[model samples]
Target chain A: MEKLKYALFTGCTAKQSTPEQMMSTMAVANKLGIELVELTEASCCGASHLQDYDDFLSLVLNARNIAYAEKHGLTMVTICNTCQLNTAMTKHRLDNNEELKAKVNEKLAEVGLEYKGTSPVTHFLYAIIDDFGLDKLKEMVVTPLSQFNIAPFYGCHNIRPSELQNETHKSAENPYNPTSLDDLIIACGGMNVDYDEKNKCCGFHAELQSPHTAAALTGNAIAGAMDNNADWMVTPCPLCHLKLDTQADHASEAIGREVELPVLHMQQMVGLALGCTPAELGLKHHVTKVDFV
Target chain B: MSTEHKITTQNVNFKVFRFNADEDYLPYYEDYNMEVTSEEVVLDILNRIKWDHDGSFSYRRSCRHGICGACAIKVNGRSTLACKESMNDMIDLFGNELTIEPLSKKRAIKDMIIDKADFWDKHAAVQPYLVAEIDEAPTSENLVSPEEENALDDADLCIQCGACHYACPAVEHNEDFFGPAAFAAAYRFSADVRDHSETRLADVNEEKQGVWDCVKCFECAEACPKEINPIGKITKLHQMAFQEGIAKNNVAVRHAVGFKKSIVKNGVLDEGGLVLYSEGPAIVKHIPVALKMFSKGKIVPPWGITKSENLDEIKKLVKSSSTAKF
Candidate 1:
């Protein structure tokens, strides 16, 4: 198979807060023969934080970020669901409107940025599944994580609004119940389970806004996992992992139940699949102990 | 499962958020395995849970159909109109499992019953009723042109459902930001041709507490059962505010400009530069914050500018825009 290569867009959460995920991803990518060209100069994807403030401003901000990838002849692959969707939505907006495209190109010209819109924003989940097929993934898993009952958390911003996703992925993953992570988990020799809380927001973004509400929503997910007896909760977005992992103890109290569930990112799981021990996967940093790993 | 998948069972599990009438304790989830079918709507399941499983379970509903918008409960994290949403639709989207909770962004009273008091207050904050600019009362029945009526059609569909309000991140994050449903209501009056007081009504969005505060996540649009696109309307309100010169501050525009300039100059966002540009002299107030973040290692020094040769292309892109200046 041809080598898989793309520009890796690691937004704020991953870059500043959780760099271990990036390291684990690099480790996993090397094992899978995928090339990640880090866009070190790239800015924030103008997530809802910026976009909602001003539509046109965000459109151009994301447009410039995409232009960097286009300049290098690569599609933008983002780890954070928010960044992925933001860049995807910006591309979607640019693709349909010629006037916006022309104007955005002009703004890019000011600082030597121009986008042909050839580059598509892809979530890293799809990067592993659709880009590097699960069959290829299975061949690489040194250790099969068998019987590891995992509940897949597909964060809200990741899959819905089908227009933002690739047609192939849009068909492969349902917005209501996305299975890319599940399929990946299964490929790594893990069993994906069905639970009431399998697909929902971890309310990670809301912690700064409404701490109680965020805790309650996250608690709901843990409570659902408790009811279903999930050994671990795995998610793609770092923000979701942050809330689900760090907030589990507090989440348990808020939901008025005894609950504790460790959370893991896809790459860390990938690292484990490649035979990296829990210590190697940076599992020690996780607030909830994954002693089983 | 494909979209055709349906849950065919008499005892469908319902995990709902429950609180007591006494307001005595933290909220909890109570599972009720209801004798319901795939043909039933969520409202039917909820009614059955209240009537058969536990009579103490309190929820508000009137006009059992979609009109009243009283039974707006969150079905699996989405603020959905319980009366209209079908179980099969949910099954196709999600699986056979159903998790119900009280409307987000509000206080919970009892099982599936949220305090709509704050919701109604925000609704009233927008002055939902219309006021005609004409001083003289029309002798004949008030008539509106087709074009004007067409403009109102989208906003007219709001059933006073607080679904959008519950789904809005702005409402959840900023206490002051007028939410989607209220903004949609504000747009309805502002867009009305007969409403002469639109200029003053539009002034409501002039501050940080208004339309500009929205994070534009589009959750409201996703949650709205009527497909009102309240966030879309909120954007239109921003445009109106811009046009009417009600938006006095240059914060959003400055942020937008700063965001682009940093990209063009550095091929990345200059957080320091962005702060200077977006906040202007107000940057002094945030020096402590910058220091705090720096001590935390969150603030990484810029890697310095890359090749400026591509920057000309970015400049050309900036100059090509209709309004934005680099």
Candidate 2:
């Protein structure tokens, strides 16, 4: 396996809501000798906001971020699936639309950046599998995570339309149902639980508009994980972690039982194995604390 | 953190999304605190809000057991039938401070009741009724196996409540997208083993508004109250589209075909090859409108075309999985 370095683009939500995921991801990257360069001046990928409110703004904001990555001579790696999707989707459009490229380049010029559409945007999970090689990952764990049974929730962003994700890099054959997370978790020393509904989304889009259904949807996954006796629900995306973990308290109240399962970003679990403390990774702020080793 | 096992039996707050089109202002929240028991469905809590707090608080609800699908509303943020979701789950997930609202991205009829007439009209466009080409009434009854019945059950349980249609991003962005609920209903009649209508697939394929428009978000499956897997139904419809050779006019079909071709060849999606083959020159006619998008930098050549080194292993897994299926 060869070593790789990347300019890490921690999108807006990771800095605030799910910083633990970013820190732990960097921690694991450091442990594996994968250089993750932080892009401090990097702005938001406009996340779901641009998608929901304004397409024009979403494209511009995403274009600017891509221009930032392109200038750095580094391919971008994103922790947020929405950020990854937005950047990839934006990049796809920018490469094809000459007029959009001209207009966005004008916008980028305002910020002293240009759009060439050369660099690729990917999630951290894909980088580990593609760059580090799974066999190498399988070799690095100091502490075995055998006691923990996990349900790996791949939110919408990492694996979607072929235009959005390089499916070869993604784990699932069927775009909707991918088994990559199971393999990744196993390599990291955790037991993967096969729940009938593992591939489903946490209804994050619905969370902004219709929250009850979002709660129920999140609740179902938490309950399903608990029913399968999963110790912690491991997810690759921050949006799923935020919606599922922050909303679990509400899900438990709705279901009339304490659905106390904590959801962790995949990197946090890896960081723990690399001998990093939970406090260092911002694990304490999570709605449910994962006490298991 | 307190490990207080005792459940708090308090009156929970509901910050409801209130709307009346006659008013100058758009719909906004109006709070109501209500008492709830362990078994109270969200419909019960809303009914209490309507009856006691404000008589003007109007919402539609029929079968309280989630069979009617009429009481669907956005609790917190996800779409759900108010009848199916209990109050306990609400508090645990979002805390006692809750926000109840009608489905966003839809024309609100009054309070939580949305004008589903457009949905029904599009549904009718798909011709949802059984199109069986049989003359016999019945010798006895059309009995289906449990496995067969289970396969079709998810699509059948949809009560036409438009939560799925409301929650879907594709349907919201593209009005042409047949919307999740309609696609599910299309699958329901299409998959029915009892209906041997040759025109079944053709009828669905004929509609400009069909399964081809779906972005495969799985929001419909997430919103379904009966645990009727709409996502699986949509995928099955995609499979049917390919098997029946009806993939000609579908956007989603191209993805499925491309996926099959990729797996058979490189064991993954080849964006360059897929775009060249799937939406080629004939699709070039649509490229003019797509160019406005291109001008916006919304389209590009996929970053890389190189195949993964483990393509053989992925091929083996696909082969082994399919053989296991057989």
Candidate 3:
């Protein structure tokens, strides 16, 4: 068997706000023998905010990010849902429309780059199921998380608006009831806690706009998982993790109770099963304490 | 002589929502078992349930075709037009059991029917009508360029179905949110070259309840049956707000501008700086979380961060591609 390599595009949240996501992803990739080539030169994917501010700039920026992966001749894998959406959307638009591609390429030419659309963009959760088989993952799990009930939060960007998601990834999870995260949890020998808000938005993007509304949304999702007896919540997107972890105070206010739920990045949960130490996965960096370990 | 075509039948269990404000304090589901064929639409099944199983089974329906948008309901957790959704497709997507409910649980007035008063209120708040110049009543056909019409994109096709309104998580969580349907309607009228509504952009430029409140979840877009991307229209409203200098000092705009500035300047987001930039002095509210995050090594000081290696390239791209002033 050959090594599965990818151009790792760790968006700003994992790099800045939630460094543990980056740390755990690296540890898990190392354990799985998958080579991750970090795209250091890649800028932000506009985070859906910049796209609203300036769509052209967002398109060109994502075009540049994809062009770098095309330059590397490897598939671009993102740990963040918004990055996956924006980059995949950029690729989809570019690949389908020659005129749009030409406009983007004209911008890229100034930076001495070109988007050939050779590289496909995908979230790490999908990458695990598609590239690294769940069966292979099951075999590598030394410490199964059967003791804990894990709630899988499939954030909106990676799933909804299926037109873009289905175009980029080979096996797009059903947006209505996403099971890739749950399947991964089951593969790691963890019990999947069923909840209504499992496939709902975390309100991360609206945090800056309406903090109270965002908190209420997060509180509802966390409360739903808690009501179903989930020991901890896990998410593939760092933005969701950022909100689910950091907004405990506001979330508590909205839920009318003290809210304390340890939120883990998708890789950190996988790392636990892969026999990585809490320190190695940066679990201690979490605002919400990881007592389940 | 008649041509013969194969019709496959399968047993499907329909779990329909049962609620009456007059009698039921809480809503419940009633199960109806029926054998359905591939030729049937969801409306056909609903009609059969009302006609045969229970004449009391209640729902809304208008033009049986997909146009009227009156038969929109939740089918197997997705808000869709019952008249347009094929039985075969639903089965293919969600298996044998289908859960049917009203567009919104909170607004449910009866089985498969919701009080659309709030939806209409929000739509009205956006002033969803052609408001031409006060003095200029159309004496002749008002000409609109093809490009201007094309820019509306399928926004004109929206039948006010309320599917996007019900599907939006923002609206579900925040009552004040104008929702995707309202915003799409706003864009349709506001962006029209014919309608000279000066206050259209200002109307939807609110902080906690307007275009800014949209979380970019894309749920509304997914729920739109006509392929009218409501999120896209909402973003266009945001762009128009910025372009027309509407609500320049709004926190959402400030946050967005801050985000763009951070990316263009450093090639990546400075999370710490962004908080202060977005909230201004209100950053004091987040001091505890900031301190906690700093202690945990989740965040670092501005000086501690590394600028992107290709910062020059990023700056050039931003300067070249963006004409909108942040």
Candidate 4:
């Protein structure tokens, strides 16, 4: 049993919007006997703006972060899918595009930074599943959440664009493709149900651009969970949590039902079943309240 | 279940992801070798499997008419509504060994239904509904002439199914990008004669998420279930936004504006000057980006390029084209 460690890249949301997920992830890592070193000086993963609005700006921004991680001699583990995609795409681009790399390296030299493109990035779930085997997870489960019927939401980044994580992880592209999240959930003594709309977007962009669409999309997930008689919904992405938990009021109105579905970050749920307290798992920050032991 | 429906049947194998109440949640695919008909939709097949074969195989489908967009799933590698896609299509393609799953880029809800409401926020953010200004009572249903009303008829048919958005290369890179549906819907409002174009453009231009993010991949056009050409609408909106000076944040706008300057001054696009002018001092940023290109000798200097001699004709074209709103 080899202990796994990660250069944890929590990004902005874990620091600002959904601190609970970060806490839960850390708790789960501890329970699984995994070591995590936080990247403290890491600034914003450039968020989603630079990629959409400015191409060159996005390249420079992501290049800086990748160079930082490479210098540290550790693979980066991102909590946010957007951050994962940006950093991963930058690494992909840097590896493929030599001229771009040289120019970026020239600028990096100005700032005392050089990107050698050595570090590989992984999502938190990848570390949990591949590094912390199912055997270890089953041992850590203190309470089986058998009373709960849950739907798993993959969001967008966990799957899709095999280029993000590389060809070896292409099997993860299909949302239906099984992952350790489901195994951990069921192992914790919780019931995992087949849900409709489990892979739908939470309208994270809608939060900034259009509240109505965000409400409708988030509402659809809530409604789908309610329809399936799910006590709560579980997702690995914190951005999805923000939209799913915060948009309950709007989702409730659209579905014409009290769709008060609480969304638990997968790490939070895993932590709870591992006998971690609500405070330890940071459950208080979630917009939807969860009854935890 | 409808009495008016005439059902037919065929033996097929469905590798369904099953969940056990007491057992561990291992998603083993069970081959429910069953019979299905040509007229029967995928949703119908699932209903049969749940009722007779497996009681716990849960999924979602409603309105069956394709209007609600609830039954979307992947039949082969392509996304389609379960209610709308006929089993005949599958029999024709993959035959009995059909691997049905929820849509890609979403969480699998169950057998074949995926949570597709994410596009709703994108639609709402783009302000999907019609917004018109009519102080006086319109004599006839907003009184749109056939020509003005039909201007964006191609853009109006988006069902918001989200296949195009998921398939797009640009959307994969840019999270803030509103993707095809938002821009298509934006054009829907922008093209309306009664809608306040200035106000609408203001809203469209306010964010990085608007039409500016489109890389003109045209993948959305291919994925559109409806005949609507979303890429065309995006192009139209780009022209409108550029001409109105509302599409200022767009990287493409830098190219457009610089090209306009070239046409006006040198009678055609001065290719070398165009890049320098469009990027300005920001061209310094390219030093880092172009290093690999420089190493490969692909980085061409932004100078000594021949300029277009048809600058006057291009200016005339821009001037003459300004009157017609795309």
Which is the leading candidate under DockQ? 3
The digit string of per-residue lDDT tens for model 1 on A164-219 reads 55352533555545678888889999988777566665766444324455677788
Tens-digit lDDT track of model 1 for B29-131:
8888766677889888888887888888888889878989999988767678888998877766666567888886247767777777766877787778777
Score each candidate by Cα lDDT. 0.71, 0.67, 0.88, 0.64
What share of the reference contacts survives in each candidate?
Answer: 0.14, 0.01, 0.73, 0.00
* Global fold similarity of model 4 (TM-score): 0.57
On lDDT, the leading prediction is 3
The DockQ of each candidate is 0.20, 0.03, 0.75, 0.01
Better of 3 and 4 by DockQ: 3
Segments in model 4 whose C-alpha atoms lie over 4 Å from true places: A162-171, A176-180, A254-256, B1-245, B248-326
Can you tell me which runs of candidate 3 are displaced by over 4 Å? B1-5, B134-141
Give the CAPRI rating of model 4.
Answer: incorrect
> Candidate 1, which CAPRI tier?
incorrect
For DockQ, candidate 1 versus 4, the one ahead is 1
Model 3 chain B lDDT-worst window of ten = B133-142
Model 2 C-alpha RMSD vs. true structure (Å) is: 18.4
Which scores greater on TM-score, model 1 or model 4? 1
Count backbone clashes in candidate 4: 33
Put down candidate 3 lDDT per residue, A1-293, tens digits, no spaces. 58999999988878788889989999999999999999998888888888777787889999999888999999999999999988888888889999999998898899899999899888888888988899999999999999999999999988988888877777867888778899999999999999999988888888877777788889988999999999999999899998999888888897688777899999999999999999989998898899878
- After the best TM-score superposition of candidate 1, give how far the Cα of residue A104 lies from its true spot, in angstroms: 5.9
